[model samples]
Target: MVFAMLSHAAIAQDQTVIEIQSPVLVIDQDRLFAETRLGSRAQADFEAHAQALAAENQRIEAELIAREQELTELRPNTAPEEFRAMADEFDARVERIRSEQDEKARLLNRSREEARQNFFGEVAEIISEIVRDKGAVVVIDRRDVFLSADRIDITEEAIALVNEKLE
Candidate 1:
């Protein structure tokens, strides 16, 4: 039970003017990636991976619980010094496991972010093409814009094109 003691623990807004000199398009970039085939597939893949990680954590927790029980059982018969060393080694092992698991979680989050960014990059060219076709100079995230007129937004159009063009 002593080994269990050691291992533990653990938005913004704004809006801007609509009509500028140059044509501006707004994209719900989140929606765009979330809707496309590539984005959808990436998301599903990452989610599955995340679930696997969760299962792994649960498994580790169970194993640790069992280890703690075993250690507790041995504590009474063992010599004080020997038990202390055993506890210390057990603590060290737990620390390493924690560090490794934490790193894995970080890597998972980083990979998810990187996948999102890469999806955005892949869609960027599609966005550019739409921009050129519409004679727009700049595109803004839909969430950022304070106000905007209808028909100017090319998010839906971009999504359509992205799904159509990319796998």
Candidate 2:
């Protein structure tokens, strides 16, 4: 009778262990961001803004070059003091333009970061929903796992959920 009881207890313990294992789902967050509609739109907007900034920088640089060329042409004919004043003014303008451009670049970076944070916030909620629906006890980023079966990956499902929620 003791032997049978011990065997029954061991079987129950094994069953509990099996139940505790649950399921682990992996998500490729990079893939999620790259494939999602919202992410793609954000990327496109950022690229467009960056291109506009680059064009404006080019225009300002061209103007600076023109001013420098004009200064070079006037240098020999102009009085020393007058030439010095023009050079000083040109240097100051260049500095001001550079400062403004730096500030604009910093603002763009901050905006991009904020957008990313918002995207991740939405994704986190979607992931939680998916975990509950799929009976998964743990969800890990695919990048963190060195070896995982493709069957355990829920990236596509997660992306679908994200798209549905975001849209």
Per-prediction backbone clash count = 1, 0
In model 2, the runs with Cα more than 4 Å from the true position are 1-24, 145-147
Q: Whose lDDT is greatest here?
A: 2
Tens digits of lDDT, candidate 2, 1-167: 99999999999887655444448878887788878998878878888999999999999999999999999999999999999999999999999999999999999999888877878887898888877876778989899999976767889988888889889
Instruction: Indicate the worst ten consecutive residues by lDDT in candidate 2.
Output: 14-23
- The local distance difference test score of model 1 is 0.84
Best candidate (score: TM-score):
1
- Report lDDT per candidate: 0.84, 0.86
> Model 1, 4: alpha-carbon shift in Å?
77
Q: Score every model by TM-score.
A: 0.81, 0.77
lDDT of 1 by residue, 1-167 (tens): 55454333100111223332337888888889889899999999999999999999999999988998999999999999999998998899899999999999999999999999999988888889888877789999989999977557777888899999996
Worst ten in a row by lDDT for model 1: 8-17
Where is model 1 more than 4 Å wrong at Cα?
A: 1-22
